[model samples]
Structures are given as C-alpha cells and as structure tokens.
Target: MRDDSTRNTIIFVVCSLALLLLYQVFILEPAAQRRQAEAARKPAAASNTTAGPVAGTLPGVAAPAQVRVVTRQEAAAASPRVTIDTPALQGSISLKGARFDDLFLKQYRETVDPNSPPVELLRPEGARHAWFAEFGWTGANVPGLPNANTLWTVTQGSTLTPTAPLSLQYVSPAGLTFTRQIAIDARFMFTVTDTVANTGAAPVSLAPYASVQRQGAPAHVGHSQIVHEGAIGWLGDELRLIKYSKWAKDGGMELPSRGGWTGITDMYWLAALIPSQSENVRGAFRVTKAGETNIFEANYVGALRQIPVGKQVTETTRFFAGAKTVPVLKGYEKQFDVPNLNWAVDWGRLRLLTQPIFSFLEFIYRHVGNFGLAILGLTVVVRLLFFPLANKQYESMTKMKKLQPQMEELRARFKEDPAKQQQEIMALYQREKVNPIAGCLPLLLQIPVFFALYKVLSVTIEMRHAPFMGWIKDLSARDPTTIWNLFGLIPWNPASTPLIGQILDTTLHLGVLPLAYGFTMWLTTAMSPPVGDPMQQRIFKLMPLLFMFIMAPFAVGLLIYWTWSNVLTILQQYVIMRRLKVDNPVDQFIARFTGKSRAA
Candidate 1:
C-alpha cells in the first residue's frame, strides 16, 4: 500500500511537471516570440505617425485631422512654456493649450545606473509616443473660449515651484477672460484651477474637462499578464480597469459617477486625474487610430455651469502623475478622499493575503533598512506563525518513518493478499497512532502565502531595483550570475553563444540562490520518510533538482524567501526529530562530520 501510494504520487508529480514544461515551451514561449516578431515588423515610420484629431477633444468636441510629427526638442521649442521645477519633478507646461506636456521624474531614473537619464513621463505633443494632460473649458456654441491653438500669456510667476505657483490668462476675442492657476506639491500632485469671466453682456454655458492623451501606443504593451498596463480608475461604486488590448477591442467605456478618478497606468507609473470630489462627472476611456498607431485617451467632463455676465466661475481639478508608491497613494487617497487609489497597484486576486504580506514586509524593511533582511525577517515570522502546524506535521512524518520497516514487511507479506495488507496497515497505524496525511497540511497551507509573496515582489514599485547582499543588485529581477560561465569567473557570456546559450541563460542558469534552495529542499526531503518503491524514491530524489531549474527564472527575492523558509523548516524538523528520538539525516550528517554518535 505504501509502495503504491508513493508510486502514484511520483507519477503524478512527474506528469504535472512534464505538462507544465511542455505547455510553457510550446504555447507560452512561441506566443511571446510571435508577439516580439509582430512588434519588430512594425514600420520605423510608425513612431513618427503624427496623425491627429488630438486637441479640443472631449465627449462631444471636434478633433483635428492631422498634426505634424517632430522631435521633443523641436516640439518644446515650438511652444511657449511655463517652467516647472520642483524637488521631485522637472517639467514645462505648454502655453499653447495650457497642457501639462513635458515632464521628467527627478527622483527616478531610466535604469539602475545613477548616471542614466531621469524617467520621462510626459513628452511634447508632436513627439513620438506623446503623452500629456490637457484641460480646458468646453462651451456650447461659444466660439472664442480658448481652443487648442489659443496661446495663453503667463500673468504670474515665471518658474512654478512648491512655494510659488503660476497663473496663465487668455482673453478670447468675444470679451471673455480665462485664467488658469497651476500649482504643484513636493511630490506628484498638481492642482489646476480655471476661472472664466464673461465680460460680454450675455451669459455662456460652459463645462470643465480634463484629458490625458497619448498619441501612439507604447513601444511595448501587455508584455506580461502579470502587470496591468492600461486604463484604470476608482468609479463611485467600485474600481474599473481595462487593459490596452481590451480597451481597443471593446470600442470604449463610459461611466457616470459623482466623484472619482480616471487615468492611464503602466506597471510602475501612473498618470491619473482626480476631479472635484463633490461634483458629478462623466468619465470615459477611448482609443482612436492614426494609420497603424493607436491613440489612447482617458478623460472626464464636469456638469455644465452657467456663467452670468460680468461674473466668473472657477473649477479646480487635481492630477497625480508619478510612481505607484503605496504610502504616497494612500496619503493622497486619505487627504483628498480618493477611494482605493492604491488599488492602482495590481494586488491581484489574493488581496486578502498579498496586502498584509506587503504591509508586513514593508514594516520589516523600514526597521531593517534592507529588503533582503526584510525578506529573511518575514520568513522567520511566517515560520513562527505556522510552527504549531508544522510541528504536528513533522511529528507525524517521524512516526511514519519509524513505522516504515513494519509497513514494508506487511506489504511484502500480503503482496498477493491486497485486502489483508491494507487491513494490517490500518491496524498498525491505529496501534502506533500514526497519520499518513497530516504531514501534507503545512504544504497545503503554503500555496496562498507563496503566491502572495510572488505578487508583492513582482508588482510593487518599491521592490524594483531594491538590492540585497553580494551579487544581488536587484531583488525584483532574477539572479544574474549563471553557472554556465562559472558565475563570471570564466569571463564569458552565455548570451553570446546562441540557441543553447539562450536556454542556459534563462532555463538552466543554476544560480546560487536556486542551488541553495535546491539543497535545502533535498535536505528536507531526505529527513522525511523514504518512499517504499525504489523507482519512486529515485525520481523523488531528483525532484529538488528539477524544481531548482523550474524556479531559476523567478525573482531573487522570492528565491531567498523560499530558501530561508526551507532552512527554518529543517531546524524545526531536526528539533522535532530529536524530541521523538527518531533518526534524521541532519544528525547523521553532523555525527559523521564531528565523529559523534548519531541519534537512535
């Protein structure tokens, strides 16, 4: 019975792994390659596709036919601008449309290298992949109300700063004066207030509108399903999200809510608009096409307001364009009553687990000042939390190991009498108070915890570029040192070699973390009861090596967590085995190393 169960478990593990490997190699990898090939096939001229219909666009506003493409420098040179120089941001506001068109995140860089250029968020309008925020008054049948080409004159400060804000004024030909005051905080929030005074003898109907538009799709979109890249928002009742591919395929979406936020989001960055929390607004996400390029837009239109003659109406809206940091998002969410803004971070379906894990990890990180140490701290916490369950599990396994010889004898004696063999095994189990399945409880409970950790390590911007100790510069990335080049001692790159090289770099890298995890896995398995079937035992012995290869490409942070967990499990099992007076490989190995007597 023991032999059959072990054989069945071995077969199951082997089949599952084989199926997963085959599916990944044939389906997922080929699909990724085809996507790369399709992206490569796009014309270089597509980057220059300045096909327009960009400006003066709202739910009902008309769009222009075409706009010329130009370099970011040339586009910036073409427009008069108000300089924005904040501690965390450096950008310029284009006066032509009063658009937030040029922005660079001063606190972040394009790469881990300190010398790399700062992260460019909003490029100029005529530039390739131009993304910017536009705000204006949409009037009904009122012509000279500051359209796209209406350039504004700066009436206030020259350089916009946290201490000093700037205001721009535009007077239409029809006796209307428009004033826009733009202010920014030390972080990423920007406040824009628009006041229009009807100087003529007649009243006008006008509504405020804000739009975040991108001329073309990002160079790479939907690279991974793990990260959400597209339109996301917190509508009145719930959060709404649409990926880029689905956003284009589904035509578009419209939602009417009292107070909410809407924007386009990438993995680590976000450009969102927060409308007046007390006003009703119509929010929309739209996609248009220019030649082969797809243009994306997310905007909201406020309710129409009646402006009396000689009187002015003011509307204020806030914008958030920066990294998806949890504390920052939560701060804004609380200060402005924005619900679930941190939901912008893809917490996945495991929010119940992932959120708490990330919070705990962040807390530990704050105390330790290193993400690697935080991960180790988390592992220890998790182990302690599950110590009682794990103790019972290891105790059951120890009892099973003590009864293994008797079970084998019963199985061999009743080889021809299967029913009798089962009966004897059950009687023996009753006599010895052994449970064969209690050992699986801890493993069964670990799946959710493991997946939650994976989500935290993968999606959070805080984990990006976080370094661990020696040779681990980025916790969010896979281990860089590969065994193929003897961990850089050979001074050869596997990537330079071609087919097998690519495989070695990705699939079979066998880095130190993965190897350490594999060793711990083997040690834990060795301390457990041996499988009765020889073939099953041999395959089980190789399972750790197989898993090492399987886990080689995951984030180094996850590998560290798992390896440390395994070490803790080993210690727990050793202690339990010592209390039970059961023989374990740890004591045997220690005995051999130190020439001491082994545990009986």
Candidate 2:
C-alpha cells in the first residue's frame, strides 16, 4: 500500500509537470509568435520605417528627373531655386497652403508595432495630410543639406507644382554662393526655413505666430494622460500658450511661463528655440489655433538685433523634417526630441527599474531570437535566485499540512467559543513555531517582477510578429483558434473550417492548451489544504475556471509563464513533502529545524 501511494504521487507530479511544459510550448509560445508576425506584416508598425522620410513623397518641391545624389558640397554648388506662388490675397486664408499626398501617408495610422518602441504622438488627424505649403516652415528633414537645416524663400509669384523642378540657393554675405539639387524617390524630407530679415531701420517687435484649423472633429486624449513641459502640465482644449523654462530662486522651474521669447524650450509634443534678440531668427514652431488650417511656422528676426545701419545681422532658423526613427533623429540630435516611449509606470523610481527591464528584453530578442524561450529563461533564473526563500516557504507549508488534524481538533473543541478557538489556534501556532503567512513571501517577491515583465512583453516592438513554431501568429492578441461557436453548440474547428468561412467567423476553435491550463490549476489547488470557511472554500473551488477565463484572452506567452511557474512550484512542494519529515501533532512536537521525528 505504501509503495502504491508513492507510485501514485510520482505519477501525479509527472503528469502535472508535463501538462504545464506542453501548454507553454504548444499553446502560449505559439500565441505570442502569432501576435508578433501580424504586427511585423504591417509597414507602418515599424518605428524605424515610419520615422524615415516617407518614401516617394515630398511636399511643395517637385521631383527632379535623373536625380543627382552627391556630397553636400557638390549639391550646394548645384543649388536650385524653389519658388512659392502667392495668389491674390483671397478671403482670410493665407496664400501659403501645404498639401500632403503620398501612399506612405497610411503608415501614420494608429496601431501597435512590435518592432518599434512605443511612443505617444499627441496631434489630431491633421497628421494624416502631409504639410505642402503654409506661412511657416515645415518641421522635418530637408534634402541636399549636409545638416538637416535649410530655409526656402517664396519668390512671391511662382506657383509651386508637383511636376515643376525645384532648386535650393544659399547666398552668403561674403559671396560664398552654393546650390543644392532635390529629387523625389518614393520618399522625400523637406525642411522649411523662415528667416525674417529686419530690412526696417528700427528694432521691430515681433512675436512669431502660426495656426492650423481642424477640418474635422477633435481627437481624444485620455484623462489619465498628462503633457509634461520639463514639469507636468495639462493639455487644455483651446490654445495652450506656455512660457519657456527659466532659472528661478528655488533652483530652476524647468518649465515656467516667462515673458517674451528669449530662450528655446520643449513642451509636451513640441519644441521651440527663441533668440535672445531676433536679427534673422530661423527655426520652426508648431501652433494650434482656433481655426482648421494646421500651420507650423519658422521665423528669423534678421537685422532686428540692435544693429547699426548697414551692418546686417542674420539669424539662421533651421527645421528638421523626416522620420522620427532613432537613426534619422540622431542626425539632427538635440533638435528632434519626440516623447513616444511608454514607460511601465510613470513613478520616477519605478520607471528607472522598468525601463532597464524593457531594454533587457529587447536585447534578449536580438540575441536569443525567441521571446518565448527568453521568458522561460528569465523565470528560471528568478526562481533559482530565490530558491532559499522558496525552500523556507515550502517547509512551512509542509509543517502546516502535517498539523491539519490537530488544527481541526482544536477548532472542534472551541466550536462554541470563537475567542477561545482563536486563542487555541495561536497557542498551537506558537508551540509549532509555524507562520501561516510565510508561504506568501515567495509569491510577494515575484509579483513586481511578473508585472514588469508583463508590461515589456505587451509593449515591446521586437516581439511583434516574431515566430515560434506554427498556427499562432501574434503574441499581443487573443488566440485565433477558438474551440466553441455561438451558445457553445458547434465546434469551430480550425482544420476543417474553410478559409473564407473562418475569415467571416468571430469564434475560433478552442484547443487543448487552455483546457490543460485549467486542469493543472485545479490539480495544484487540490493538492493543497483548504483555507478559510465553507464560503471561501466554495469560492476557491471556482478559482481554476475563473483563471482560465481571465487567461483565455491573454497572449499565449503569458499563459505559458504562469503555467510553467505553477508546475515548478508543484515539483518543489513534492520534494519538500518527501524529504522534509513533518511530525504528527498527535505524537509530539518534532524540531523542524533539526529534521528529527519525536514520539508523543
């Protein structure tokens, strides 16, 4: 009988572990792979691809035939002139109109990318149409410039057409003239420089202003979201006029509302550089006014800097227009700082820890080439590191399980007096030196790590559309194969279901993995002692079903992690049960620290 009991125990443990490992690899891992694959299939979902110049489209400037790609010096020597045509001042609309027409425009749509780091872009639908022409400079990269900085001068009457050839001419006061060629090769980055020359004798007071009216309804920004300008600031509906950061008595109010444009500062989703005094200020500023036309202006206050007549002062304004990816943005360095990366939790201390975790996950993806294996390896490392703590917990649970009969007797004896029952239980606990909550320590330690990893797996771009084995295509979405149909009547079988029929159907055929997950959780719970009163036990019995429901929609990778962790814990418990001898409370108090069994 003893041998039979041992064999049964071994069988149970092996079956449970096998189920967990299989579910993780077969179901969870594949689910994650599916999610990653779907995301990778979409071009706009890639951060690097989206940030690069939209291939095949340039606003304002027409594509040149037989494009000449040469060094900055060569392009400068061949400088071409681009003329912006201003029509008869019609109605209230400015003659500077920018139109964005490109096939790549679809890449800007809202969707999660597994390859690109996540970022928050706070503009409305105006981004849908590329800026063609406006009164202000377009904020992006300019072609043919060594550094992504250049200004275009509208020769007043020349109409800018898509087919017309354009050129850039840089005229220096020392007669150092340079010309640059431009072309459209499926993608183009044009930077608009606005240098306002102070041709007037007096110091002209100028506060550069630009606005764009929304042709459609406003976009949504959630309540939890906040716009930070060095410090946190709320993004109000109407025009939000914020002053630049300044040096104050109490250190520096990083984002303070100051008078007049004196220094450049970055606000939520926007950056601007203001000159101490405008001579010919050349820089781009994004403005959102009450009207519909979205206008971005760059102005240079030229010769307005308290300069004597005939001594011309030039303030060169530079704008960067291109992709917001790391490489392209790095070219323009300090100028292009777009806040898009989503940190797990916004708390300063937690964010520090969370960011590195995400960075590490990204690194692992590059090396190991599989996120599923990465998660498993990470879990194993964490568990091994905390083995000592886990051991302590398992020993405590073993002792408690052995004393269950004594505990039940104590409850029965004090059944009439609730206070007496509690006192007896405490006394018993003291005698046994057992801590009920000690088992919770391991779980408590793992919660934060688990949550942080969860965030990384959900948001990291590298894991998107990444493959594991088969069937599963995306890690971020629910399992595509569902087991049941409407009213749980028909089995929506993946193998038998036709492709066209499956496409129209919302239900997916349920598979074995989810069922295995549910069964393992139930068995793990069954192997443990009951807690709380009858009501709690009843609720506890429903836990496995509840967990399966909750987890059904989660990425297969997460389910794999959870299932595998449980399996390891079960094995650990089994070892503790066999090796760590627990004294029968009816017999005597055996010293648990020494592992010696004593007789009553």
Candidate 3:
C-alpha cells in the first residue's frame, strides 16, 4: 500500500537522464572525435577555385595557378591595393586581380581582449587561408578576355570608400574593354558594376561572374550543431546550407536561378555574391582539388550578354562581406530583395518562435545594456506569460500532495488486488477533482520556448563575448570559473594539469552560476511531492546533480536564463502551495529553521 503519483515522475526523469547521457556518449562525443581527427589530417592552404576568369567566366571554372605560401601580411602587400576604410570594415582590395581581399571587420575582434586583432574576413591569395570575393567577365575561349590572373589597372580612385568608389579596367587582347566599378556602402554590401565594351570588329558575347572562394579549411573549424560554418546560400528561393565536410564529400552543388545569393558563411562572418536581381544566373557551391589542395567556392554567373561592335553592356552585382548581424541581414532582405537573406542566421526549425524571442531579447538588451540581464528579464517575461498555466499545474500538484494520505489508505485497502487499487485510486482522484497528469502541462509547454531561447542565444553574435557578473566574461561560452582551481582563487589553471586535466576540465569545472542553478533545481525538486519507491526516490534525488553536470557545458547565458526561470517557478509554486494550505517542503524548511511548528 503505497502512494505512487510521484513514481511516474521519477521514472520519466530517470529515463530522460539515461537517454541524454547515451546520446552524449554515443553520438555527440564520437562525432566530435571524428571531426577532430579529420581536421588534424587536412593541412592548410591547399588550393581554391574561382567564379569567373577575369571579368566574365563560367561559374565553378578552375584556373590553373599556383599560390606560393606566404604570410598574410606578405600576401596582402604582394600587389598594389585599394584601401577599404569604413566604420564597420578595414581592409585592402587587391588590384592584381581586382579581388576583394585582405578584409577585416572593425567591429569584431579575434578574442575578448580589446587589443586583439580584428576578425580578418578576407585573406589575400597565397595566405594560409585565402578567402576573398572576385568579379570579372568571361567569354567562350575569346582571346584577351579577362581571366583570374589578369592584372587590372586602376582607372579611378586610390581607395574604395562609401563616398568615392573605385574603378578598375582591363583591356583584352581581342579589343574588348572590361571595366569594373566597385563601391562600398556604410555597412557590408559592396556594389560591383562590370561593363564590357566591344571595341573589336565582331560582337563579343560575355558573362558577368562573381565568386567567394576558400583556399583551405579555416584554422578553427566549428563543429557546433547550432552554428552553420561553410558554404551557405539561397538559390532560386531554395536555401542551401552545406557543411565543409559534406561539401567535400559530395563534390559540389549547382543550381540555375534568376536571382539569388551565394556565399561562404562562418558563425558570425559572411562572404556572399549577390547577382543582379534582373538577370538570370547560375549558382554553384563547389569543392574541387588542385593537386593536393582542396578548393571551396560559392559563386554565381549571370546569363551571357551580347556586346555588339561599338556597343557596351553593364552587369551590376552585389557582395556582402561582414558580420551576419540580424538587423543587417533583415535590412538587406528588405532593401535589396535578397531572397531569404534573413535565413542566414541559422534560426533552425523554430524560426517562427526563435526570431521573435531573439527580437524581444534584443529589445530588452538594448535597454538593459547587459545581455545576461536581458536573458534574466526574458525568463521573467516567459514565466509571467505562462504564470496562469503554471499556477493551475502547481495547484493540481498541491491537491495531489493532499490526496497522498487518502490514496495510500485506498491502496492498502486494495493491496490484495492491483486492478482494484488502480480503479479506487482513479475514482478517488475523480472525486477530489485532481488530475495527476495535469502537472506535466507546464513543462511540456516550456520545451519549445526553452529550445528557442537556446538557439537564439547560441547563434546570435550579439551574445558573443557578452559579460555578466564577475568571472563570467563570455555569455556564449561555458563558465570560465572552475572549482578545480577554487574558482580561480588558487591562481592555477585546471587545464594546465596533466593526464586527467581534460577530464577534470570537462566534468569538475563547476562554476558559481551552475552551482546556483543546481541548488535552485534541487530546492524545486525538494518542494515537490516525495516519491514512494526507494529506487525512484533515489533517482529523483540524483536528478539535480545529474542535470547540473549535463548543463555544465552549456553556455553561461543559457544557464543564467534557466536558473532565473527556476527561481521564478519556485516562487510561484510556493505561493500556490500557501494559498492551497498544502504541506510544502519550503514551508517546512522555514518552520524548522525558525524552530516553529511544521504546519500549514
């Protein structure tokens, strides 16, 4: 004769914990190892492909060339350059091939340190990772057509600025004049206008092409599930996101579309080639090998344009090379009609919910000036939104707690027959107007919202390097304070230890925030009805610790949000239990501490 209402809850918690552990050990860890092994095998600066030859070439066409290994500084200085100076960007364009290379984001740094180097988005050819955008004209074996190796003469400005655009000109041996006028905006978009004049006796058929090429894998490849790092683009209204390993395995992808954008995107940075909205274009995400080096290219080529003798044709395209901020992307989507450009943020399947959540969180952050506080405020908002439902669930839980004694009596009376016990229990519940399963509704409703917040926080660059209270410098990263070194008070790094260092760093590096979250979770569990079975109770008792360990690797922002949410829920539950006059652990704890009677 035992009350078993909490038995189901214990079983559910235990099973969920087991499944999470199994998934982590069997799926995530192994995949991470494989990626690590693969990354170790691939060397840097192998090779790359191009979108066009000089000014007009077919998409995915590879030009025969060897890039001498050189330092990034040396490669950037190897040729004459056009300085790109903007509030958001600082770099130099290579005049050698009229390539948008040697670009750095002025707004973002390589690390949290203020003096850290700015994020280098585009590197010059021959550098360790040569990633840049190039635009030119390509004709069918037409002599003197601009090719990848063609050196262009600066016909206009010394620098490409938002106010003063620069123009480069290349005259083909076949008497065709290719002029490229490149202009930058206040933000990331770059407008390139390619004009081809047919000075030859015959008409010249040419195509305008642009490409974003990566000579090698990035030094630090991200294996995060939430962030997309590789070739990503929208083709003819279809969004394509291909991982680097998958792209290499599948060779490449090609699609024909009237208008779309193609590019290589990292978690925060993007380098995309947007074709003219008025012209039909072909988009290709290709990975080819030049000798032992693997080349990755995302490019678009507009339909061929005929420039009759003494006539000229102009093809204007756009390039986006900068941070993939939500506002910037959405602005581009609206202003330029870049199809599905907002999808560049990798909002996942819950974009409907995640987008709004992100916007709201961003709105709060703009006012609060601290992302961590914004997350805390967001948790409060979500709790308030679901407060009524949660109150009903907690009230039901209180009724169940009150019915425990009566249920036990009924179970003991019907101990001889299990079916009778279950029936009597159901009838008693119906008589009391209490439903055991009603308590689960609030949790079920929270799953999606919780996941949406996780996605928003993890993928948004705004959360990157966001600081909370002391020792929590980066909200997007795991807690840096480790108990292994007494939370940095010992003046020693746990990572510097030998042998079991990594293991300790992973499992024993409990931070203050996570500890607080664990305590709150434990308190919440303690306030709930106690389980009857010994094993069930033991498993339930261990859930808080187990969950704390599991969530230790999660981002600090997520932990803060969860911890704040738990506090709010605890307060709500306590208030409900008090109103219901139910015997709750919180009341009992306070009574015992104050030496008062443990009575509601």
Candidate 4:
C-alpha cells in the first residue's frame, strides 16, 4: 500500500509538469503572439467636432431666453483651444487642427493651416523642422467609413512637454491616455508614441495602415523610396530597384498597374493609398505569429474596426521618418529597422569578412572629413591585410607553371591509360610536396568579399552627393570626369571604336577609378598562368572586359575600392616574383627555395 501511494504521487507530479510545458508552448505562446500583433496594428482613427450653427442669429423678433442660456452654457463647456509655441528652427511650422500635410518627405516642401476644417485639425503645425508628425486621421469619426458616426472632444489636460522626462495624460473623446514623445535629433529621424484604446464596452478589432502621396508625380512614376537601417528599395515607373538584403529578392515585386504603386518592407514601414470603391479593394494587411510579424502595403481603401460597447483596448507604436541618413537613423535605434543600413552588403557568407572594410572606411571619414578619401584608405587597408594570402597563392601558381613540363612528360608517358596518367600525376605531386589547391584558396575567399563591397558602396547614403577630388562630384553616383571624345556626339568619350567607345564610356568614363580598375586587372592577369586550352584562354581573357562592363554603371566609390585593391595586389605579386627569382629558370628557382641540388 505504501509503495502504491508513492508511485501515484510521482505520476501526478510528472503529469502536471508535462501539462505546464504544453500550455506554455502551445497555448500561452500563441495568445501572447496575438496580443503583440494587435499592439503593432494601432490604427489612427479620425477626429470629430461638435455640431453647431454659425454664430449670430438672424433678425428674429425674439430669441428664447432658455435657448440663449443653453447656448452660452454649451460654449462654456467646450474645450479650450491649445497653442504650440514655435521653436527657433527656420522652417518650423505650427500644430492646430488635424492636418495630414505635415508628414515629412525625403525631398519636398510642406505647409499647414491652423484654421482649416476638422480634417485639417489633424494637420500638425511646426512640422517643417520636425523629423516626423502624426497626421492624416485623429479623433473618433474616420472619413469614408460606412454607417459609423464619430464625436470627438478635447479637454484641458496636461501633456508631457519636450523637457519632461515622464509620460503625461491627455484626455481625448475616449478617455485619459498615456503618450510617449521622442525628440528629433537629426534631419532624418523622428519618433512618436501611439496610444490607442477600445474606449467602448466590448473588445475592439483594429487594423492600422499608413500612406504617403507625393504631390508632384503620379504614384507609379514617382520614386517611391524606403530605407530601413541599411536596406533600400525604390520603385520607378518601369522598374523596382533594391539593394542587398538577407531576403532572396532584393528588389521588390513589380507592379502590374502603371499608374498606382504600393511599397512595403516585410516588418517595417508600409505605404498605400485608399483604392476607389469600384475596384476590388484588397486592403493593406499585416499578421503576426509567435514573435514574427509581417506588414503589407496594398491598394485597399477602407477602415477596419469592431469596438464593443464598454471594454477599452489601447496600444502604443513609435514612428521614425526622414531621409536614409546613417547617423540620423542610428540615433533612433529602436524605431529604424535596418540600423547602419548594412544590408547592402549581399555576399552570402563573406559579409562578416568584409564588414571590417566598411568600418575602416568610416574611420577614415572621421579624420579626413571626406568620404572619397575614406574609400581610398579602406582600399589600402584591405590590400595590406590580404597581402600574405595573395602572395602565397601567386607563388603556388608560379610553381605550377614551372612544373608544367614535368606534368606533360608524365601525361605523354601514360597517354593510352588515363587512369595511369592521373595516378602518376598524383605521385609526382606527392614527391614534389606541391599543393594544387593552394592556388585556389585566395581567389575563392575574395569572390564574396568583392561582391559584398560592391553592395556596400552602392547604397550608403553618406556617399550620396559627396565629392571626391577633381571632377568627380558624387561617390554614390556614376563618375562624371572625362578627357576626350572619340565621337563628337558621344558624351565623355575615350579613344576607341563606337562599340568599344560605348563599352569604355560605360566602364572607364563613368569615373577615372574604373579605368584604373581595368588597368590593374589587365596587369594581374598578365602574370597569371597561361591557360593551355584555346577555349579556356579566350574565356580568361574576356573576364576583365566583362567586369568592366558590369561595373560601369555601379557607384564610383565601389570602383575606387576595387581599382585600388587590384593595383596593390599587382605590386605585391611583382615584388614577390623578383625576390623569389620565380621569373627565372625553374631549376635554379627550385634550388634556391628548396635548398636542393638539381638532379643531373
């Protein structure tokens, strides 16, 4: 009886533990995930004003005494108007009614009027100097919603000032709510707190959306741009261009419609205009599962809400808006998605190896105060760090070239038996203590590094509009310096045939750096082993030209790094060849390096 009781107690304890684990993994986790998703979808609702007649009653014989008293009482009960003092910033504006125009733009001007309608009340004042603004919809009644009416009232409530360290409460039509405020530290960064609540009797279902429409261009034609920390995507009328990112598709999906456009980052910023009612409105949507959340931007136009009668649900979210400036974006570390915007470095496994290169370039920028020089410094540092490895590979290749005669003799000796030929070659390699794979390691390691650096230079905003020495104006743009023209009509022409001229212009004339890059590539290949097969030689010879063609349209800063790296490698190889005497007779070279007398 005692043993049975002990066994039952142990079994009960084990069962309870198992049940707890199951609850946490399956039930509690999913519920927590749903709550987080709701947190991210804090929809911005529309504001409302009290209905009233215009002031000054018309010429009436007598006004009701009771009506007059009620009117005065209603006026006294209205919320007092709040005023925002303008800061010292030159482009500063004011906040008053709900104004949507106060939202920031990457490269455009904006304004706001305080005396506009209720919708205009959402318009923010003092936005010109602010990094971002909460505009578009505020209050209870959202525009374009069917069968739903809203009333909004503001009261004399204290708000956390810019200098205040603690959160403050402001009474909206719903109830008192806590709001967090973030200061704009730079030109491109702004953050705001989101306070949403289900101020009704039951649970409220809310779907949040954000949209931006530039005034000057149509949606598709305009450059719809987004930069998260390090990744950037842009949509032109014809193509969607994207930089490097962890995701397979760097450039976003192409749009079918030529007139309207929607852009979104998977878990970050999203924008889309409300679609017309006649169109099949598949509105913008987002979902979160576990800890992963996905945000979508679509051509949907409508509000989503299900507010119960009494229960209150609320949420807070932060927004960072502005240009894709690294320093500015880094300041708002929590708000921006791609801090440092390093996603442009797309080399799959080599991203880690090449990160130091960017760090070195940034360091150089700190001292020299110019981005172009920083690129040059980065090139020098990379070349020096890889010098030993590159030299070792080149030396091995040189030895392979010298062994060619011996290898050919072995091949001839066993020409009829391919298996025997390979065995003999392996034997010869072992006897000579030569490693064929040694020549491949350096090149293999460099491929990914090269690709990653290519991406880094292409999208870094610090290089945008930054000037290098001489005629080069922007490191992030194609090089503009040119010497002479082969054809009078061709722009920035180099001395070559029309076809060759186009190629050269595409590669070399984009900047002086690419020309330097091509020259170094040519030199490096000159010292490399000559391919024995005709087809292989032809292919090898075309590599430099292919690279030049590919790099012509790339940003000049990348070209600078590539060009300098190639030049340094060439110099290193030249010095190694001279010092080791590999350029001379093979027998003598072996005697010196191996300390062995040649077999006579």
Q: Pick the candidate with the highest lDDT.
A: 1
TM-score of each: 0.94, 0.51, 0.93, 0.51
Stretches of candidate 4 off by over 4 Å are 1-97, 100-186, 189-318, 334-357, 384-388, 408-428, 481-511, 584-600
Q: Which pairs clash inside model 1?
A: none
Better of 1 and 3 by lDDT: 1
- Global fold similarity of model 1 (TM-score): 0.94
- Tens digits of per-residue lDDT for model 2, 157-201: 243332333334444342222232222222222333333333334
Candidate lDDT scores, in order, read 0.84, 0.40, 0.80, 0.41
Write the residue-wise lDDT of candidate 4 on 282-376 in tens digits. Answer: 22222111111111112222244454544433332233333334444445333343222323222234457545666667778999998888878
Write the residue-wise lDDT of candidate 3 on 63-131 in tens digits. Answer: 636556677888788888888998888998887778888888998888889899998899887776688
RMSD of each: 2.4, 15.1, 3.0, 20.1
Error of 1 at 56 (Å): 10
Q: Estimate candidate 2's alpha-carbon lDDT, on a 0 to 1 scale.
A: 0.40
Instruction: Give the range where candidate 4 is weakest over 10 consecutive residues by summed lDDT.
Output: 215-224
lDDT score of residue 474 within candidate 1 = 86
Please, what are the lDDT tens digits per residue for candidate 1 over residues 356-415? 999998999899899999999998988888888888889888888888889989989999
Off by over 4 Å in 1: 2-30, 59-65, 591-600
Candidate 2 clashes: the total is 65
Stretches of candidate 3 off by over 4 Å are 1-10, 25-30, 41-64, 597-599
TM-score of 3: 0.93
